[model samples]
Target: MNPASPLDNVRIVLSHTSHPGNIGATARAMKTMGLSRLYLVNPKSFPDSEADARASNARDILESACVCTSLEEAMGDTFLAAALTARSRDLSHPTRNARQAAGELIRYAHHHPVALLFGRESAGLTSAEISHCQLTVQIPANSAYSSLNLAAAVQIMAYELRMVLEEGVVADEPDPQLPEPASLQEIEGLHHHLEQVMVQSGFLDPTQPKRLMRRMRRLFARTRLEKEEVNILRGLLTAVNPHKPT
Candidate 1:
């Protein structure tokens, strides 16, 4: 069965792409997988002849690639956005390998439009850019020489997502039926609440609190806590500091 939406509908966003050839190659990759939506966020150059030459017949992808002023604009309405990065992020947003990320892309696409984010070629996505995503995607590489080029990275990931579309799942992923995650606003509030509790209880010394919060934030992000877990934590904080005030 064909995908419910056209390839033109799948937006492949590139932030600060420096190579024209890589942009062309990325278009080819999406075309081969029947995914066509390409969004360019402040790309180095567009309508480059080199890019068109590399795209060949897939020039349509280049021709139609949406140019956005910012990454925020490109991914604003997208329900699920995954930023591909090679290194670990400092804030430690949820991370998934290529295969697992492909599954999530499929699942999220079931309800809302999804966006796959790619960063510049020299260095992959920056920490700030990754923070913009709900989760991060990393491809497992050999212990040595782990760097992947922009086009190659997108090609590998796009191939994985296409495989999921072509071949149905062999074993279904577990379904916990958890409610949606708390909004970013609520999560930020939870962090503030937790911070207040830590300070009021003398659990964290103000002078050394940065390291403590950084590690704790990393620990908390991995849980991918559902709305309920966050609520539980909020309630726990209230119990701990009845008079601390939010």
Candidate 2:
């Protein structure tokens, strides 16, 4: 283990992880790959027996894992944060497979502390959460069933890094995105209005909306709407409303 190698310096961040076992397993996976840094950002549950038990031989990692109150705090000093999202997101960040993500990690690790952030098992990374990351890793999978466990996502990325680092093929170029990144508050407001419009248009039924929202999320994600585009859509939406604000 190069005490100072990229893999050693890279931190595996679990954001709002719900399961203790996943936390333990994530530590074990990180350990198995010769990684030691683990960060927990507002875990739903930690310091539990199951998690400690699952960590088993890797308890040191659990003990050493930094507990952070927020993702921004956990990402402190990290110039490169790559989040694992099951599908595309509205924010346009460079999307890569596990290999490419690992390569980027290693490339940036020398100058800065890099983080690989994974979200909750059910929701994965939220749009607001994804905004913090500089890039995203999309594991190629069947479109029909693409869900993967949070820990599993971490393991795959870790394994890829271990392999590529051993072969010494780590390098990266710049990641491109919209010139002006939209703010989180802006997106939240837009989504709220969007939901109302969908409901008013009878496109999204409140009763069984999970799937519909999921699909809509994917649609907006694919669009990677820019700030100007978001404004245009919101403006058009407002213009059509019969009762405009005075």
Candidate 3:
């Protein structure tokens, strides 16, 4: 059997999309760029006639889309996720232009599943939602009217990725012998374990987190943690709190 295409490991994730037509248009856009994986997180509507109609000749993309209840769920198996947002957030992840991010994303996708995350049409990704991502990608547009339609944003990103792939543009490749990158789910587990230890140790007050964990997340997100590294950190946390359950 042929090896899976790197694009196959790159999924387009739409979260809390309020409009069905945008979802269909997004599928159509992805299809045009040779992207097939689509993940919908808590969409307002799906399997709707409007969406089907908007999908045009790309109904198969919509039909195969994965529906998720949460952004975390949508990104569970992904090793890297880039949040597409025009708005600035406090302590946001490292920012990259669309073209720059596409190169990096494609490089990572060659090793593991990666995601390009888009938020709702009316409002972009929530701060908490963006926190789940490792990088933030912005499509350069007129500052006076930076807002882009949901499908349009997806199309822009998909086009950039397609161009990167076609042009053979990729970021500095990591050593192939390095350990695999940790999945989002695994990283989340490490976060949870660290938070539990922090709360128990009085380092982080649950009542007033005051962005403590958020900062930690930002720090770790920059690390591009590996699977073994995550396990080692979790082990350290456990060692620090031996009484706590594993």
Candidate number with greatest TM-score: 3
TM for every model, in the order presented, reads: 0.72, 0.69, 0.94
In TM-score terms, candidate 3 sits at: 0.94
lDDT of each: 0.76, 0.76, 0.89
lDDT of 3 by residue, 131-183 (tens): 89999999999999998999999999999988987786564365767778899
Q: Report the poorest 10 consecutive residues by lDDT, candidate 3.
A: 168-177
Query: Candidate 1: worst 10 consecutive residues by lDDT?
Result: 1-10
lDDT of 1 by residue, 39-112 (tens): 99888888798899888789999988889988767886565678888878566778899999888777656545
* lDDT comparison, 2 vs 3, better candidate: 3
| Cα lDDT tens digits for candidate 2, 1-246 | 667677776899898989999999998888999899999999988888889998879999999999999876787556567889888865356789888888877876655577888988888878767766667889888899988877777888889989877886654332444244333344445666777777777777888875565545445544544567779889987876555576
**Cα error, candidate 1, residue 109 (Å):** 0.5
Candidate 3 ranges beyond 4 A from true positions = 1-3, 171-174
Which sections of candidate 1 miss by over 4 Å? 1-9, 170-246
